[model samples]
Target: MINSFEVKETNEMIEKENLDVRTITMGISLLDCIDSDLDKLNENIYNKITRLAKNLVKVGNDIERSYGIPIVNKRISVTPIALVGGSACKTVEDFASIAKTLDQAAKDVGVNLIGGYSAIVSKGMTPAEELLIKSIPLALHTTERVCSSVNVGSTKVGINMDAVKLLGNIILEVANNSKDNDSAECMKLVVFCNAPDDNPFMAGAFHGVTEADAIINVGVSGPGVVKKALESVRGESFEVLCETIKKTAFKVTRVGQLVAKEASKALDIPFGIVDLSLAPTPAVGDSVADILCEIGLEYAGAPGTTAALALLNDQVKKGGIMASSYVGGLSGAFIPVSEDQGMINAVEAGAITIEKLEAMTCVCSVGLDMIAIPGDTKASTISGIIADEMAIGMINQKTTAARLIPAIGKKVGDKVEFGGLFGYAPVMPVNNYSCENFINRGGRIPAPVHSFKN
Candidate 1:
């Protein structure tokens, strides 16, 4: 349905507003690369990834130049490594070797990051999964561009409190290991509830086993464009505002669909879904929080913030689904504190809190993303936060994730700088209350009664 657009219309959106494809990710399944020998497994994975994604970076660059649109990152997401390495790997070193191979493959192909160094423990952890999860701190610390994720809960299955508790300690260990760089390694890890299979976003993406051998997925972003559109409808009713946002999102998602088509064609791979997530950057105009403020909120975490975010998220999906029939992934607005300037500003002010962000996540696509907490924050407390968020996603039947950065040697009000697109975040305060007892009660939290709709 996307026909040729007027040159003037396209230029206005690209040059004036921050409209661009966020990522062109090639999802390469490494399932067949599995081997019972650890060394052979690593070799097979590296070969498969390199062979499948050889032209990924060049293709993305070509698309960006030919279309005059920015394609920010070229990435790869492989089959979840826990399953792939289950037969071969035994100890933490074996898992880390696979991570090393992934990192090498990413660099070899000129990709920015490679995801799927992950474990899906929603039901429970196997011996292999437990080893992979335990090795995450070392794997992430040693590898430059390898991202890891762990799925701890879902609607069908209950929350794995044991995995949640272990991840809390693992997060702290990762932060402590990379403290000199402001816990930069922690930025590459994520904890998810109801994790998506086709997400093109980093730190949480993995090629689900259900997917094809190789496919191309695109992520589109245009918060600045949405904000600009809202400016024309200032003081309008909620009905008018929602319609305007939907129209803007439609146009934005169409761009992503076009890019996905081009990339799939050029790479000779199947065209996967276009992820219509409004991913924000540190740039001033490109921010989800700015859109929230334009919707009549004074700040991002104000009293009505949750309501505003809910409206925005719903309208975005409505608009995007109209533009692309194959829309999948975590397709909604992201609220990473470090990635959005408005969110960082809100944190610097007293407007936002950890608890407030939790409330907002119930409406947003992801939960508690890129938030920097105090160094001394207890592992039990982090697990407690994860439990609450997992509960939200399971009950609501949506995807939610946490990427908390424990800023070592920094307390509330201190700044931890990641620079570049990661931006900087002021270490936010956490409640001093202990949740050790609750976290220590390590067992599965049963699925909600409503999940029995069979």
Candidate 2:
């Protein structure tokens, strides 16, 4: 099954490039855990997660050893807790306790992060959902490995002003409470439109209602591989470069499909989606920004960078679509500022700015991720940033999210270190324009005009 050119590329990926499977997520549906009795519900939650994911870490390690490809993270995304636990609780604290239990379960199973402690309040918020939203600060602050998200808007229902309002305060509280960690807690939270279920990525994954009781999904990452593929044709035309990248992505996604199929068969779980995100680690050779730079941009924020990213995203999808029928998630390149070394270097070198990053998000996969801003940045300014990204997703009918950290005691040009996969970032400046009146409107922006097409 191996052709000469493809084998050569694969060898280059393993030897010179840091190509590897990023994550193998187990989507465990927790709907069956819901119960009228709080104690029974918690017991079911722990038992289900433990039973499904007890051997996940071992299996991932064994596969890595067998294939010589590193699996960066082992993660799980459960059904939205608000749906399962919302009706069982009356107080925010009660819901937070449930989050703590989930965190412990993740630790027990040897997974680094567990997602789906979230609510889909795009249309409206129920009492339990409201309580959970308000308790996110405490839950995320107290738990080490729990990731939370809220889908406050979607193409179908437009943006929810009430949910958006609460998120501003929630983000502020999460930041302020975790200020000792450079507001690292805020990094664990994401607000989005059209969030995906089988996303084997962190901070924004939730098991959708359409999924089976349990399934295995894989996230494949190889920015270095794609960049290396582009390097061979340095002076090639743009069309040639696009072809190279597309061919490389096809190979990478095929590897992902192979790995997911094998992992699913071994675990006796149904195979799920292959999230073809160019997820970068804090390692030396896994930079998503490096892909952009190698694609002929001086750095990720150069004048033509957005156009380059748009092309890259399209070609990647085109190749991946041919590779597998189960493609989903943010399947293009990621531009998380603090997570990629080249992005950190770009920000330090004055090649990228917050505004340009925001503009780039219009075309890229995720929006304004892991950006550090001045501690004194007003909550309203943060709200304005969220509103802007939400507007892009709402209008384009794509998924976009913001994860901005207001680092306490840090200013523009100052750096905040979050250690490990979170990497580091110099504070990026936000515009001084006031959005008080707009944010203060305190009412929904209403569903976009496109939503009425039905």
Candidate 3:
């Protein structure tokens, strides 16, 4: 239990910084559901999820109400289906059916997003993994809440160029197929490098084989809270700001640890990691970009913002590490352009650009998230963006991803609405450079020299 001083400090930080719990993710391992028969596989997946997650929402709600803080999303990430249903499926459509079943199960259990509709082909691709990857467009198009990811690279085995090549086409297909939803369905897809299995955030979360049969992880976000804490210290020295952010993050993460511990106890599932990402919502006051702006930038994406974010990201991790022994996932500030109102406003006002966002990815969580590019953009360009982001993750020994949607027929300055938490974005331009040579290298970019440390 946290002491009164800590709690008081956290509350004060919340009042001044706009901090709150971002998400409470429950991880349900579906590996046990794997069987020779597809029907049995489906039944097992549904039953295991239902049993493990039956009380997830209730526990989250109770925690939120009791703590007087918001638990914005109640999400579930299951084992990657390619691993679970690989031997059972004969066709891509079979995999699609499995995806549908998972989606329906999430709805039945009242969860918002059901992740792990994914394949890990970073080293090589299995037949089932190949089929599932091919079916992502159909699965994501047809299902309401199913999120998918394909891990194309990692530090140990490097990236599989074949898989990387396929993803370029896959994303385009998903974008074209879901055009009616403003390509919002594509928003549910993420391409990752060194992806964590126990992640709880949507579009990227997945239950890994190393997890327990069932576990509940909490992802707490409070960018507003962090920003509020920095407001009065605007004219302070950089070192002072770093210290302030660290102290503030300590309190914010403490709240998350307390809520996750209590919630896990109530659910009777072992406590999983506390993903300390500054996940933003479409809500006006809850924007991560707003937090950046409050830290002295006129808006997110202004010059000097990346340096500020780098310090903030590092300090948050330092504080969070002190606060919890189980801190994991993408534990940093998220700059999803669409979901964050401040980011959206920045893009619209020309204060931020795709190139600057790319640079910011060096020090932040996730990359090119919820960004809209011109529909006419070449597939090679999309692949370049992905490769660039993956390179950052691979080289930095950190988790980074790209969740870009090329809105068909939409160009720069045009607004694409995704509705709800998906939010809206003004289409941003990508460089006109041809990435054919870089992408065609057709082999893994070796892990960074730093990753070779014994």
Candidate 4:
């Protein structure tokens, strides 16, 4: 029902505007893989992932060639390891071994990355979840192509301050573990509030307990396409600007819908949702901030930035939902300072700061993402940042996340190059005022009154 575009137009959009299916992620439920023995659990995970996703990369490549659409990544996600390994992983090392198995499976399957090496502790942590949290630095250090996420807050359950405080130190330790690579391991980790079950992106993607045994989810991104569409409506009325964005987003999501169907058919997996987001890359012209600039901001952190971002985000959802049969994940514009060249340029020009980025996150898809801070910043400060973002998501009842990288041995004046899609970020200064007392208070922040709905 969405075949309202000419083939030439779609190809032009892809050839010129940096449009691509960001990832074709297979969500494999590993609930049945649970076992009492650690070795058996690891073996189950590896065999199941390998068998179910064996053709994932090949199918993605086949679809890319068949349709001439670029599928940037072929990846996999499984049930959160915390629940799967609870009976088997009695020690931190036991959890780290699972990470190794995941890395090996991902390598063998030839996918870009494997997620769901994760824990969901939004309310409180079980003993097994606590061990997973403790093993993060070691697990990340010892493995490649494995991503980890922790959910520390939710609208119904409020903020988990105990888990939040613990992860603050774990984030720093994860960064320290990969300092030689500019702490790039931090790029593979995310701390979430209200994380979604079917998200196809990393490092926050996992097969939620509510999902089916196996499903195919597609992530499609095109900030460049949106930026180009806005250029045609320069100085137009706000209504016209909104309409143009919606139309462009519809087109983008349609592309993703097609790719999702083909991949599902090829892999014999059930079709999941299409996440059509304005997720940017480091390339010039492929930036969410650039779309904002075309929407009349001199820079992304300008005074009117948040309002502009809210408008863009709303219109994108409206159009994408119309095009796709199902739309989920964090389907809007992301504001990662490292991944968007426009954001990186804004940072270099001093047009954006961490505080302003936090404000922007209130309306954006993700929060305080891919931001780098000074190496010497206190862990309590990091906890304070997480608490603030989690509070925003909890009160607003929207999904939000923080992927802060404290680049070890780096300062505010210095920059870090992560290379490839992780890109690079100029270190931003964090507020030096201490919040140690606030962070040390080991209790949950109660959900706001608005969340009392039955």
Candidate 5:
């Protein structure tokens, strides 16, 4: 297994093609830290996080230095605050205070971000869960590094239209609260349908109750590597193109497996999954759209975009499964507009629209991600959009999420620059027609007939 040729190829992928591990996330369960006393609960949460994750960043750095693999970020995800604070958090303010404690613990440990300020109200909400949901805008507004998410629908339980309706207004409040930062606080929040238990990525990651106390999960990305491989097979048959993607993805995932094994051994934490997603950044040529273009599209929203995305997603999972036994999370191609420069270019060129992006999510890893819309768009319309995406995920049995940023005071043709990996996005136009009548209906959408499978 130790071959010079393979080592050289891996080195070239890193040095030339922007290949790197996106994140090495430590998932810590906070169930043991719960308390009935508000002050005691906050103290327990902060102390547990700091004590367990004190060596996270240092371990990541050591691994990167020793293996010459670029680990972009070290993150932590914990038990959803809704469950952990249920006994102690009697009010919305109590839940918001927990966010501050989580933020402080992250700062002390030197991680880039800490997730799990979230609720799982897929079918219904407990009073405490509802309070945590209400506190999201304030929690995110006050905290620097805490990320939040809510799972409002799933195949087993159906869509919670009441929670969906509430989230629309909550997201608007989050946008208004951080208007000075281009409404960047909205970027730290995600609304999901069919959310996974062990996602290592931000805004949607929570340590499920079923998981171990603490574990190591790594997210590895290489959109540039895929695009470059596709270029080598230009004008080839579909069979040939598919083969190249599968092989290249296998190699990329092997890199992730190496890093995950090394980090698990060093940190003495049980290794979780290696999420082999082709997650893009704002950097040049490192885009999921670029891979689509190399697959014979003029732009990302071209005629065959969905079919191309489906093919790429399938082959990625196929190859990734062969590389690692524990392949999980959103392990496919991520098509976020702001994070992928090619997608932003597509938007600026008038080649992509919100409707087209929604259609694309049926096949991509996430739904309508990192998109910026005008502030004037109504909350009902946002809820309507969430309902549509939830229906897609619920029926298809796939993980789908929405991370929309309604730029305050920004309209179509205006751009908001978030910089860094959170990139910049042009305010794409949203349909102005009112969906108020439909969104006002406060009830659940029953699960599909196919959900009755034993």
Candidate 6:
């Protein structure tokens, strides 16, 4: 029920506010592709992905042209490879071979990135999952478009300190291997607690077991659009400001609904949820931090930053849920340092710190993301950071993730340029104090008491 006036407004938003569909992701299930033989396993994985997503890019293009809307990325998410390739990928190199196949499939289909090179070890790890985790450094270093993620904790299962410790070392290894690209490989890797099933966003997207054989999920973003709406009420009350954001989010989500339905129909796949996340970009005017500034903060990490972010995230969800029957994924404000220009500025101005970012994540969509820390930061410190975020997610029963890049050979104040969507980041300082004893104690942190409900 998009009326003429709404259509015109959407057109204006696209032209002026940097509004668009961030991604049209096709989730393909690879459960049936499992084979005990490594060669056949890879062949099945490649064939299934290519067959289902062959027209994904083309359909996205047609939608963009027909509706005069921009579609930034076309992505694919598959079943966690640890489950699908467990029988076949007996060694770390075997898993890396499977990653190569995924990279090739992405290139063949002309998609921006392919996800689900992942494992779920919230409680404990199986042999296959351990193997896949071990291969992440080499796999991400060798491949171009493949993304990897590991879920080391969840509300129901608690934190797996063992997996967290291993991933800390693995992330450092990934950075070391890809130092030539300023640790670009780490940009494609995510460490998660309570990861979502139908996330269309990259670096953490994986097709959950509950999903259908194939589906289409769209992630729509417009932080700039929200910021523009807020501008119309400079001196307004908090209630008025919240209303403005809700109305703007409603309008933005309707456009997403249109794109999702059209893409699903065109592809003959079931229409999955439309993720109403206000995902920011490196481009000017499209930042969650800027939206916070519009809320009267001098800089992003000013005193009231966390409160502003909470309001923005909650209102966006309220508006979006009313606009569409289905709203899921990390549908809130994202505060990735490298991807948001205002956040980058804040870090450079010394207004934002890693600790402040951690506090912000208590209310935002995800945890510390695309943050580059000094190269000398120890693996134990990284694990400590992950442990803290995981504890937050577990206690809050929300999805949180960390994509930390230990910029090899770089120190505080040095800049790491990853380019493109990965963007660039200044090396932020980490606490020099040691958390070695805590991380070295390898065991599961017990699940929250509320999780025991039957």
Provide the overall lDDT of each model, using Cα atoms, as 2-decimal numbers. 0.93, 0.87, 0.84, 0.93, 0.93, 0.94
Winner on lDDT (5 vs 6): 6
* Model 4: CA > 4 A from native: 1-5
Question: How accurate locally is residue 224 in candidate 6, as Cα lDDT from 0 to 100?
Answer: 95
Give lDDT: candidate 6, residue 200.
97
Candidate 4, overall lDDT?
0.93
Estimate, for each residue in 1-454, the C-alpha lDDT of model 3 and write its tens digit: 5687866776675665566776788888887789989999999988888887888888888977787777778889988999998989989889998998998889988988899999998888989999999999999988998999999887766767777878888889999997776777789999998899778788899989888988878888877777677776888888888888888778778888898899889998888888887878777777778767767788888888998789888998888888888998888989998888889888888999888998899899877798899888888788888988887778777787899999988888898998877789999989988987877777666666665667
Candidate 1: 10-residue stretch with minimal lDDT: 1-10
Candidate topping lDDT? 6
* Candidate 2 residue runs with Cα over 4 Å from true position: 2-8
Q: Model 4 over residues 255-339: C-alpha lDDT tens digits? A: 9999999989988899999998788999888999999999999998999999999999999999999998899988999999899
Show model 3 residue runs off by greater than 4 Å: 1-18, 449-451
TM-score of each: 0.99, 0.97, 0.95, 0.99, 0.99, 0.99
Name the lDDT value of residue 204 in candidate 1. 96
Q: How many pairs of residues collide in model 2?
A: 0
Off by over 4 Å in 6: none
Per-model tally of clashing residue pairs: 0, 0, 8, 0, 0, 0
The regions of model 5 sitting more than 4 angstroms off are none
Tens-digit lDDT track of model 1 for 1-454:
4346655666688999988899999999998988999999999999999998999999999999998989999999988999999999989999999999999999999999999999999999999999999999989988999999999999999899999999999999999999999988899999999999999999998999889999899999999999999999999999999999999999899899999999999999999999999999999899999999999988899989999999999999999999998999999999999999999989888899999999999999989999999999999999998899999999999999889999999999999899988999999998888989999997999999888997
Model 1 TM-score on a 0 to 1 scale: 0.99
TM-score of 6: 0.99
